[model samples]
Target: MVRWNILPATCILNSCIINIYDEGDCIPPHIDHHNFVRPFCKVSFMSKSNILFGKQIDIVDLGEFRGVVEIPLPVGSVFILKGNMADVAKQCISGVRHRRVSVTFYKMDDSKAPYRFQPDPELEELLPYQL
Candidate 1:
C-alpha cells in the first residue's frame, strides 16, 4: 500500500486493535511510548471518527477538544502519524459517535527491540508473500 511508504523501511514490529463503542468513548491525549518507533499508522474501520492532535489538549466533561489540528478518519482509510506530528504533538480520539474499530501498527525503537524473531505460522499461511 502507498501509505506504507510513510514509515521508514524495516521499522514496523507490533500492532494492536482499538474499538470505540460510544459517543463519549475517548482516549485521553498522550504521546506514544518511547519504545515505539515514529511514523506509525492506524487503519480505520466500521465508521468515521475524528482524531485530535496538538502540543496540548484540554479534556472537558464530555470529550477533549481545541487541538491545533483535527483529522477526520474516514472508514477504510489509513492515518499516518510521524515526525512533528508524531513526536512533538499528543493525539487522541474524541467525540466518537458510533462503533469504530482501528488496527494500529507500531514499530519498536530499534535500540529497544529484542533480537529474537518468531512468526505466527497460521498468520503466515493466511497472508500472501507479497504483503
Candidate 2:
C-alpha cells in the first residue's frame, strides 16, 4: 500500500521512476499528458530542489531562473498537482543541483477506465468491501 501523510486518502493506479542527474539536468515547462489523471503525486529522494510553475516559464541559460512561482521540494517530500494547478499552469524542474529520484503516481483518465482500478489481492484482503 502506498500511503502518504500529506495525502491521506489516495489510490495510486500507476507509478513511474524519474532520475535527475547533476546540475544540468532539467525538464522544460510542460503539462502532463492526458493519459494521466489529475491529482498525481511525486515523491522526491536524494536531494532537494525547486520546481517552477506558471502559465509561462522562461529558463535562463546561465543557471539563473525566472517563473511565476517556485515550489521547493525537499528530500522525501511528496508534491501533488491537480485541478487548476495541474491544468492551467505549466511546471518544470530547473537545473538540478544534485542527483535525485522521484516516483510519480497517478490514475489514468476515465476513458481508460477498463485499464484502471485493477484489484490488488493484498489490499483487498486487508480492507472490507465497499457498497
Best candidate (score: TM-score): 1
Instruction: Please give, for residues 1-131, the per-residue lDDT of candidate 2 as tens digits.
Output: 24434543554555455665575687778888767776787888898988888897886775545779999999998888888778888888877878877777777665665644685688656753344
Residues 1-131 of candidate 1 have per-residue lDDT tens digits of 33346665566445555665565567778888767776678889888988889998877666756687988999999887778888889888886778778888886665675677565687656742466
Candidate 1: Cα lDDT at 76? 95
Best by lDDT: 1
Worst 10 residues of 1 by lDDT: 1-10
- Looking at candidate 2, the ten consecutive residues that score lowest on lDDT are 1-10
lDDT of 2: 0.74
Candidate 1, superposed: residue stretches over 4 Å from native = 1-6, 113-128
Off by over 4 Å in 2: 1-10, 62-65, 113-131
